[model samples]
Target: MRADRLVSLVLLLRQRGRLSAATLAHELEVSTRTVLRDIEALSAAGVPVYAERGRHGGFALLPGFRTELTGLNHDEALSLLVAGLGRGEQVFGLGSALASAMRKVVDALPEGSQATASDAARRMLIEPETDLLARRAAVDEVPGDVAAEVRRAVFAGHKLRLHYAAAGRPPAWRTVDPIGLVTVRDRGYLLATRSGEDRTYRLSRVLAAEELPEPAERPDHVDLDRIWRDRSTRFRAGGDQVAVELRLRPSRREELAGTALAVLAEAAEADGVGGAGGADGADGADGAGGWLRMTVTFQDARHAEWALWQLATDAEALAPPSLRTALRDRALALAARYDTPP
Candidate 1:
């Protein structure tokens, strides 16, 4: 650990130019004395480290001093830096390992590339876990230990036993041949096989996991991307899909598109700008500046109603009559329930 800290100290000064003992201690999570000692050790090792004096003094490397290491092009270094700093590090319980790897990547880059990569990384953001409204996207919370066990089984090629809580089903135990793990949009899935049948289980729904002693029965190599694509295609095509037409405020178009399985068609209403209309209007509702008319597909009738209802006054379903009736009935029930003060 001390060795790692010493290397990190050198990297820090090399990157930041000059840093006070207190700053180094804070960055390295050690005491000031430890920082001073590490500096002495680096100097003794002929690392070209020296100290500045007076009020604005700090430790710094000699001019043109840097460790000779493998080089990374600016773009390559920048990608690693951004990914290391982003939310992807939290996937599969590798946050600390990813951070360590990032430090090493920076240390390996050519001096000029290191500074440029750092600056570019600061300008880029990847896969932010929230939207413009400050609402966090739904990422299921899987316990770290459970995720680690699953990851271990996947890497070790062992069968896995899962105490899984599948949606709307009682928690049950099942053993499956470990294939691989896949993460999309911050959600994790275990792609495996059960009794020769393909299966994909969400990591968050895994209440507990046990790595089995026996080796998994599987191919030596697998194309995981193709497998995931095939499974996703089947899932999208197999659902109880319901297509609905809706006229909604332009501002709410994205919200609608996001929840829908597929957007079959979209066109702005020809009607001129007007005030917000109620769900009782001929096309359900129209907002000021008119509304966008879209034909979108949802997982089911229930899904369609729920998506539209989320927009409240900003949207209205103008659909296959049945959907409109369902929405009206739901609204009436809600209205009646809230009619009297509770």
Candidate 2:
């Protein structure tokens, strides 16, 4: 742990020059006294670490000096190699570059450690293509040429004309002032605006793209994180927010949270459930005895219906009469269809 801390201290100082002992302790999650001792230790070890006293005084490394951590011991190299095995770079159109870098790192490893490192990294997986249940995440394929064009336009800060097919809508040409590209859950989206209206387009849905020489009318600097959050909030709020009260099992709380819905309230008790609970409990998530109730918001009635359909036996929708009635009607129709001899 001390070795790791020492390395972390060096890295922190290298990345952010001149940090007070207090700040160093905060960053390293240690005490100021520990930081001072580490500084002395680094100096003794010929690390050229120096300190200053006063209000603005702090610890810093010698000017114009830095260290490379490429001499990675077995586990370190394996970890780095494993990280590069993911297809994350593919979505950003950096697959070849990433592969080349990974190869270089592997080739540069100590001759004796090369085989061991590669074997270990190969045995492990990051973002596996299939889950334990044999479920595979769907990946959208964008034409290489099209993706290249869109990428170029985005970085060049230029307007883009796209032949986009949005959901059930037919393909149409639209000019957008491209802001940035974002990838989430293996899917990529282009954040942009049309006539000053915020618009988000799925990259896969872009059938064709052309870069315009005219500069895009976008802010010179953008807080994409904030913009993405604000856009998401607005999108969720603008739609029909039909809500459903569910009596779920204590175990499925995480699954519920991961969905595109918000839990408004919950009710869990000695049922081995945790935290405060006062949820409506018509029945369990499985329509059985035990239950932890929760009220969840959906985009709309249709959205609620679709999500509940997927949740199936794991969640029970108990609310607003209309929603329950809709589920019942759908269930009856399905049952009636199955009841037929054919």
Candidate 2 lDDT score at position 163 = 98
Q: What is the C-alpha lDDT profile of model 2 across 136-159, one tens digit per residue?
A: 977767776687788789889999
Instruction: Quantify all predictions' global Cα lDDT against the true fold.
Output: 0.79, 0.75
Relative to the true structure, candidate 2 reaches a TM of: 0.65
> What TM-score against the true fold does each predicted structure earn?
0.65, 0.65
- For model 1, the stretches where C-alpha displacement exceeds 4 angstroms are 1-86, 111-113, 239-241, 245-255, 263-295, 311-315, 319-322, 329-342
How far does residue 118 in candidate 1 sit from its true spot (Å)? 2.9
- Looking at model 1, the pairs that clash are none
Clashes of each: 0, 4
lDDT of 1 at 50: 88
Error of 1 at 335 (Å): 6.4
**Cα deviation in Å at residue 202, candidate 1?**
0.9
